[model samples]
Target chain A: MLILSRRKDETIIIDDKIEISIVDIKGDQVKLGINAPRSVKIYRKEVYLEIEKENAAAARSSDALASLGDLFKK
Target chain B: MDNDVKQISIPSGLYGFEGLTKFALTRASQEPFLLLKSLEEESLSFILIDPLYFRPDYTPDLSDEDLKEIGEEKENNLYALAIVTVRPGEDPQMTANLQGPIIINGDTLTARQCITSNPKWQTRHDILAEIRSHQGAESC
Candidate 1:
């Protein structure tokens, strides 16, 4: 990852459509503000990773369909 | 949990949105969608979604027991549905919200979105693959 240092009110531009700004820095926590188009989605890294893991797990479960079929057998 | 079978119509399409309904072409030929039908009528129109499509970071709310029942490992099932695709040429793909899921009361039919503990069910699933395989031997 490209790491950069910036003070409050500074900003980073991406793909001409998204802008990330440094809002404040308190202790170890740094507050940020993001600007992007409505169609674009932004999320935390951990959250994204968690969801990706879930998506992979769900995709692997062939039994779900089988169970649903079992539900119909009754 | 009452299973009083009723001939409820699924709007012939998902929520009757003209654009989204176009996808329902594939679903029409598929078998009756055997969902965990809600007891309430209002919660009838629901879809499961994939969390990665929306907020890749989501956690569900489920007890240890509920987790076992749904066959999940944690209290991390929750998501919402913005849109679902039911096409004729493609698989009937319904996106599930990994952040939230449509939960219905089988007895009252009153549905509410619930977070599942199961990490195995996506918000969106393609029903076409299942349908294709189920077709008669000649079609295959």
Candidate 2:
């Protein structure tokens, strides 16, 4: 892992396209501003991890489709 | 190529099952459940359900980048299916993952699991409870 110490208002450029800037810092919270192309998809780390975990659990679901079919019947 | 199965290619693949990109999508032996079976692996599969079936106003609020990734033009031929999680037990409880829905382009057969920023959407939503509540409301 690459580690660099940057202060507020400092910006880091990646691949000559994406830019990450330290927008604000107060106490334990720090705000970041990212500038990337439209093709780039960015997400909060925890949110992404939660989705990944849920997908894994969904894949392990039991073969209970037959039992649940009646629930949809009107 | 089974007559009922539709081949879908997810270039980026699902988050945890990233390597298994090719999938055979077919309706389960049920009214509203669909089975997404991975072509790369036999044991891997997911049961899907249209979120709107339970949550009538399930607007995922997909981002522009998400739409572009799936090649969605004017939102035509796009379908969003939520992955269902069915717990194993005597009385199984089922939940749907609405936060990250599998968006498929019917015309191109390309799909991607997209995450929504909406606070109302979550990874697990009780399917039975939702339906029961709706039924109670309708009866009134």
Best prediction by TM-score? 2
Docking class of 1: incorrect
Which stretch of 10 consecutive residues in model 2 chain B shows the poorest summed lDDT?
Answer: B67-76
For B1-140, candidate 1 gives per-residue lDDT tens digits of 12334332222222112122111111111233323332333323322333333334444553443223323332323222322323222332333434434332223222333334455544444443433344544385
lDDT of 2 by residue, B84-138 (tens): 9888676667899999999998888889999887889999999889988987988
lDDT of each: 0.40, 0.86
Worst 10 residues of 1 chain B by lDDT: B21-30
Q: Deviation in angstroms for B100 in model 1?
A: 9.1
CA RMSD per model (angstroms): 14.5, 3.0
- lDDT string for model 2 (A1-74, tens) is 99999999999999999999999999999999999987787879999899899888888773667767655553
Off by over 4 Å in 2: A70-74, B1-3, B72-75, B136-140
